[model samples]
Target: MIKVGIVGGTGYTGVELLRLLARHSGVKLQAVTSRKEAGMKVAEMYPSLRGWVDLAFSTPEDARLTECDVVFFATPNGIAMQQTGELLDAGVKVIDLAADYRIKDLSEWSKWYGMQHASPDLVEEAVYGLPEINRAAIRDARLIANPGCYPTAVQLGFLPLIEAGVIDAGSLIADCKSGVSGAGRKAEVGALFAEAGDNFKAYGVAGHRHLPEIRQGLTRIAGVDVGLTFVPHLTPLIRGIHATLYAKITQDVDLQALFEQRYLGEQFVDVLPAGSHPETRSVRGANVCRIAVHRPQGGDTVVILSVIDNLVKGAAGQAVQNMNILFDLPEGTGLDIVPLLP
Candidate 1:
């Protein structure tokens, strides 16, 4: 069995990882670290895992965390970079759910995250863990950097067009809306229900951190530097992301044929019928990305709509999928399940 350890085990992503990994056939829960919740029963903190995970939150230390074969860092940015090398040195593979290793350039990483990257040398070896695009790289990588929720939905929505050279990369604009949980489980006044509910307004329009990461992903697939105007907002609900992307098609492009042909054999990505719109609830709790295409009259712009559960496809579930690839296991071994809807 694959013994697994999780750092920063008290957050939303951390608990979601425990929820999936607890029932995972090939994994064994070994250690979970939390600085403040040390010596506390993990199940007590999140009663949802009372019977499944039988462990306590421990302090973050090299010796305690290095025991597992694979470790997941669900902490904030900069925390993973500090100990990634040490864990890798001790023969433990790592997958960071934070933004630590997402951006390639160290200067850019510093500029956006507002901290110096602790391990720039290992940046070359760290693979960006989006299973659909970088599966092979993730298989051989000892350290994987998972993408942000907004970036995941946005990138997957535009990848095919960009890859086929049908759209002009400079004119891409992403307008995304995410559920409240995407903000994490921190105690902040702005994230409270009163502030977020019955409210739909944009934040981080001036400059969001995910902007560079989105550009980096597009640049890799398009083989050119792509420009983006990304604006994200908070929805009242608790768990999903809906991304609407608009781009100018430079060439003669058959929208339906392009999407259908591109995702022919893709298991998790569902390209809906010609005019069908997919709702966020349709893909909740599933590792699925539902996409639709539209072309309005009198314009060369092609609009793409993509939806995914922010916590599942966007975070924990995708992390587990990356682990499956890194261990040479079936990509859908532990994630081939249906979405949970009300």
Candidate 2:
């Protein structure tokens, strides 16, 4: 079994990792760390993993994460960078579910994240963990930088068009909405039910942190720098992301077949039939992105709708998928979860 350790065990993504790793056939949970919650049973903090996860929370210093085969950092941005280098040097693979290593430009990362990178030397060596685009590198990488929830949905929706060279890349718009849980498990006035419930508002209209990551991924796909107008909104729901993307079509091709053929062999990305509108709930609780393509009256514009469970495909589930690739196991080993329905 592949021994695993997780840092930051009290957040939503942290517990989500525990919930999935608990049932992985090829995995064994070695350590789960939380400075504040040390010595607490994992099941005590999250009742959902009562029977599956039997480990308790320990401090990072006591976890001995270097002894594990791979360690996943579910902590905030700077936390992983502080410890990832030592772990990698100790022969333990590292996966970070944060913005620590996503952007290639160090100055850009510092400007957006507002701090000096703890491991700038390792940033160039860390592989971006979007399996669809960087699968081969992940298998040989000692460090994985998991993509953010919004970036995952946005990049998948725009990838087929950009790669086919059928859209005007300069005029791209991504209007996305995510659940309140995307803010993390912390207490905040914005995430409170009284404020977010029955309300919809865009917070990062000027520039959100995920913008650079999205642009970096898309630019890599298009083989040139791409311009994008990204706006992120917060929804009252608990666990999903809906990305409605728009681009002016510059060439004529079978849009449906393009998307279908692009993701033909991929198991997690589902391209619905032409004219279909994919709902966020259809992908809830599952490690899948359901997408649909449309052209209003065959106009000069193309609209793509994509959705995924933010906690699953966006965060922990994708991390597990990366782990599977890192170990050369089947991509869906412990991720065969069905979407939860009403």
Tens digits of per-residue lDDT for model 2, 247-271? 9999998999999999998989999
Q: Could you estimate the TM-score for every candidate? A: 0.97, 0.99
Worst 10 residues of 2 by lDDT: 277-286
Compute the lDDT for candidate 1: 0.91
Q: lDDT for each of the candidates?
A: 0.91, 0.95
Top lDDT hit: 2
Instruction: Give lDDT tens digits, candidate 1, residues 16-103.
Output: 8998898889898989999898899999999999899999998887327788899999998889999999999999999999999999
State how far residue 196 of model 1 sits from its true place (Å): 0.7
Q: Cα deviation of 201 in candidate 1 (Å)?
A: 0.5
Q: Against the correct fold, how does model 1 do in TM-score?
A: 0.97
